[model samples]
Target: MAEFTFSTEQQELRKAVRRFAADNFDEETVRRLMESDPRFDPKVWARLGAELGVLGLAVPESAGGVGGTLVDQAVAVEELGAALACGPLFGTVYLAIPALVAASAGAARDELLPELIEGRKTAAFAVADQAGAFDPAAVTLTATDGDVTVSGTVARVVDADAADVILVAANGSGGVGLYAVDAAAAQRTNLVTLDLTRPQADLEFASAPAQLIAGPDEAERVITHALQVGSVLLAVEQVGASQHLLDIAVEYAKTRLQFGRPIGSFQAVKHRLADLLVDVEHARSTAYHAVWALTDGSDDPALAASIAQATCSAAFSRVARDAIQTLGGIGFTWEHQAHLYFKRATTDAALLGSAEQHRDRVAKLVLDTAAVERVPEVAVGSPR
Candidate 1:
C-alpha cells in the first residue's frame, strides 16, 4: 500500500476540531460534565453535530451523512480525545453506525441511519457480556417470535442510558444476530466507573421488543466488523490523548523549577519526555496505518487493527503513567487533570479488548498465515 499521510483537508479538519474542543471543552466544563447526570452535555453534543458535521463523518451521503471515510472519523476522534471531551460520540459513531452499515439492507438500516447521521437519535452497542467479553457466544439474551429479551445484565455498556436506540447481540432461533431495542424498554442503571468522564451503564431487558438487523448467518460477521472498526478508531483516540499528555508533561518540565533551574534541564526528566515523544509518534503511525487500511480496504484490516490496538493501548498507558511522574506531587492530587487522563487511559485500554488480547490476536494471525505459507506443495498425482 501507499504511504499514509493526512490530506490537507484532513489536517485542516483536525485543527478545526482541536480549536473547537479548546474553546468548548475546558477543564471546568469537562469536570462538570463528568459529575452531571448523563455525563454528556446535550447542547455541546448538538453543536458538534450541527457545526462540525461530526456525527456523519463516516456515514454515506444517501444516509444523510457527510459521505466521509473512516480516516475522517479517526481525525475527529483524535481531537476529541486530546481535549478529553466526554460524550456519546464514541458509542454512536464507532460502534453503532458500523454495526448498522454491516447489517443487511432493511428498515433497521434505512430508518435508523438517517436519524443517526442527522444526530436526531443516539445508539449504543450491547455486545459486552457480564464479563465484558465481546464474544457472541457470551451473550445470554434470547430472542423469540421477533421479541428479544435480555434477562442477564449487560455490564459496562457505554452510553446506554443516553442512547435512544440500542443494538443488542442476542441468541435467536436463527442463531446469533443483531437486534435493535428502544432504550425505554430496557432498565438502565448508570455505574460509577474508573473514568467518570466516559460513563458506563448496566442494562437489563425483560422481553424488550426489538427489530432484527442481521440474522444468525450474518450477525457474527457484522459484529466483528463493527468491533474491528471500533478498535482501530479507538487507537486513534489513544494516540491523541497520549500526545496531549506528553505535551503537558514537557511544557510543565520547562516551567517547573527545582534547585534554581527548570526541571526540563535535568537529564532524567529530558530522557523520560523524549521517550514518551517517541512512543506517541509510534502510536500515531500505527493508528494511521490502521485507519488507512480500513479507509482504502487495501490491506489486512484485522491485522492492522489488532496491531494498532495493542501498540496504542500500551503506549498510552505508559505515557499517562510517566506524565504523572514528570509532573511531580501536583499530578497526584485530585485537582490535577493528569489523573483524569491517566484514568481514561487505563480504562480505555480494557474497554474494547485489552492490550494482551490484541497482541495474542496479532500473534495468532501472523503464525497462522505463516503456517499456511509453509505447507508443502504436492506434485501432480505423486503423493496419492
Candidate 2:
C-alpha cells in the first residue's frame, strides 16, 4: 500500500477553500446563487480563479497558473463538492482542462489555457453524442474541414450556456478528431436537469467553424485519458458530499427526539448512522487511491479510476438516501438542504458514467485479464 500524507501548502489550501465555501456556499447563498440565470455568478468564479487560484491548481506555470499538481486540484474539488458548490469548476477545470492538456500543442492550447487560467473564459468538453456513451463508437458527430466545421447535436453537455468555447469530439476524415467551437456559433437549448446546482444544455452545431485540437490518431487517447481524470476527481467530489451528509445525519440523530428519547439512542438509528460512517470512510479510501494513481501515473490508472467511480458513486448515493431517511420528514422537504445533497448525489452518479457502467469496466479489466493470466500449461505425456 502507498503512504498518504499532505503538505503544509495543501493544508493551507484546504483552510482557504473551506473559508470560501463557508462564506459563499451557506444554504441561503447557494439557493440564491443557483436560482439566478447561468446558475453561477461569474464574479464569484473570477474570485475563485484569479484570487485563490484553485481553478488553476493543475495548470502549468507557463500558463500563468498556480504551479501545482492534480492532487492539489483534487483537494480543492473535494472541498467544493462538500459545499455543493454551484459553479463552472467541474466543467471548466476538471473536464475541459484535461482535454486541452491531452490535445496536441497548438495555437488553441496556447491561447485558451491562459484564458481559462485567468478566468477570462469558461469551456466545456462534449463528452458524448445523442447516444450518450462517452466512447469512440458513441462519437457520431461529424466534422468536415473545407474550413474545419462540426455538425451534430450533443445532449447533456455540462455548463453549455456558461461556456465560451466547447471541445467537441467528432468524426472527421482523418478519424475521430477533437475540434474546438465557439459557443456563439452553436445553438444551445437548456435541459431541465435533476441537479439545479449543476446545469446542463443540449447543443446543436450546423457546420459550426471549429479549430482542430487533436488529430484522429490522438483524439481517442486524449478523450479517454481526460474522462479518466474526470472520473477520479468526481469520485473525490462524491467523497466530500458523502462526508457532509454523514455529519449532518449523525447530528440530527443525536438531537432529533422520538418516543421520548433521542433517536440515536435506539439500535436502528445507531446502525443506520454507523453504516453511513463505513460508507463515507470507504469512499474516502477509494477516492484518494484514484487521485494517487492519477498523480503518480500508476501502472493502471484507468482501472483505479473506474473502481473509484464505481465505489464512490454507490457510497454517496446510499449516504444521501439514508441521511434523508435519518432526518425523517425534514429530509424529504423542499426547504431542507438534505434534498439538495441528494440531488447532487444522484446526478453525479449518472453524470459522466453511472455506477453500473464503471462496475462493468472494472469487471472487464480485472476478470478478463485474470482468466487469461490464470491459464496453466499441462504436461502432455504425464497427464491422462
Candidate 3:
C-alpha cells in the first residue's frame, strides 16, 4: 500500500541485523563453515530463532508467530544475504512456511506452523520438476488412497538434508495437492553445488506416507502464490548481495594503487563502478516494489514478482562479475571473498527460475493483460 521506502522502525531492524551479521558471519567464519558438511552452525540458527525472531517473521500470530509482513521478512533476508549467512532459513521461511500458509486450513497448518514458527522443525518445499520448473503440473509424485509416493529424484532441493519435514507437491486421484512427508521416509543425497554456502540435495521418495494439505482445486493457486513470494524475497537477497559486492569493489579501488595512483581515480574503474551502482539501485527498487505488492495484496503480484526476478537476477549476476573484474586477479583467487559472492550470484540466479524464464513470464503477463483490455474496445466498437 505504501511506497517502498523503509520506515524508521524498518531501518532500525535492518541496522540491527547488519550488526548481528558483521559479528557472526565474518569472512573467516564463512570460510570455516564452508569447510564443514552442513555448512552452517546450529548455534547461529538457534540464535536467529531466539534473538532475531527470524523464523516467524512471515508467519501469522494465530499460527504462533510474530505476525510480521513480507516486507519485514525481505528486510531480514537482504541483510542475511549481504552477510552471506549460511543456513536453511531461506528454504524454511520463503518456501515451506508460505506453502503451509497458502494451504487450506487443516491439521497441516495447525500442527506444522507452530513448530516451524518456533524453529523446532525445519521444512523444504519439494516442487521443482526434474528440469527445475516450479509448475504444479510438473510434480512427479503420485498419491492414492491417502498415501503419496515419489519415485523419481527431485533435483536442487534446498536444505533437504537438514529439513525435518518436506512439503511435497504431488498429483493424486483427487488432483494436485500439497503433502507433508517426514525426512526419514525419503532417501536424500547431498549434491555438490557451486555455492557451498547453500547446499542442495536430490531426494527419492518411495511410497512415503503423507498427509494432504490442499486438494487439486487449491493446489495450483497455492503453489504459484508461494513461488511468487519466494521469488520476491529472493530478489531482495540478490539486491543485498549486489550492494555488498559493489561496496567491496569500490573499497578495493580506493585502496589499491596502480602506477602510484589509486585505481579508483582511473576513468575505466570509475565508469565500471558507476554502472554497477546504477544497476544495484535499480534492482533494489524492483525488489522493494515486489515486496510491497505482496504485502499489500496488489492486483498484479505475478507481474511484479516476474519483473523483479527478471531484472534483479541479471543485475546481480552482472554486478558480481564486474565487482570481480574491478578487484583484479585477487578477486579470482579462491582465498579471496569475491569468488564467494560470484558463486552465490550464479547459484541464486538459477535458484527459483532463471532470468530468461522470468522474462518470458513477464512477456506473457503483459500480452495477456493487453488482450483483455482490447476486448472491451472491440466490444464497444462492434454493432450491438
| Candidate 3 residue pairs in clash (backbone atoms < 3 Å) | none
Q: Tell me the whole-model lDDT of each prediction, alpha carbons only.
A: 0.82, 0.82, 0.80
Candidate 3 on 1-384: residue-level lDDT in tens?
445578887888899899989999999999899779667887787778767887778777776777787888899999998989887866788777877776667976789887876767788888873212356657877875565554455777988877889888877887777788888988999888898888888898888888877788887766776777888888999999999999999999999999999999999999999999999999998998888767765436677888898889999999999999999999999889989999999998887788898888778778755343322101001111
Q: Which ten residues in a row have the lowest lDDT in candidate 3?
A: 375-384
Q: Which runs in model 1 stand beyond 4 Å of their true positions? A: 129-134, 147-152, 369-384
Question: Per-prediction TM-score, please?
Answer: 0.93, 0.93, 0.92
What's the best-to-worst order under lDDT? Answer: 1, 2, 3
Quote the positional error of residue 380 for candidate 2 in Å. 49
Give the local distance difference test score of model 2: 0.82
How well is each residue in 277-299 modelled by candidate 1, as lDDT tens digits?
99999999999888877766655
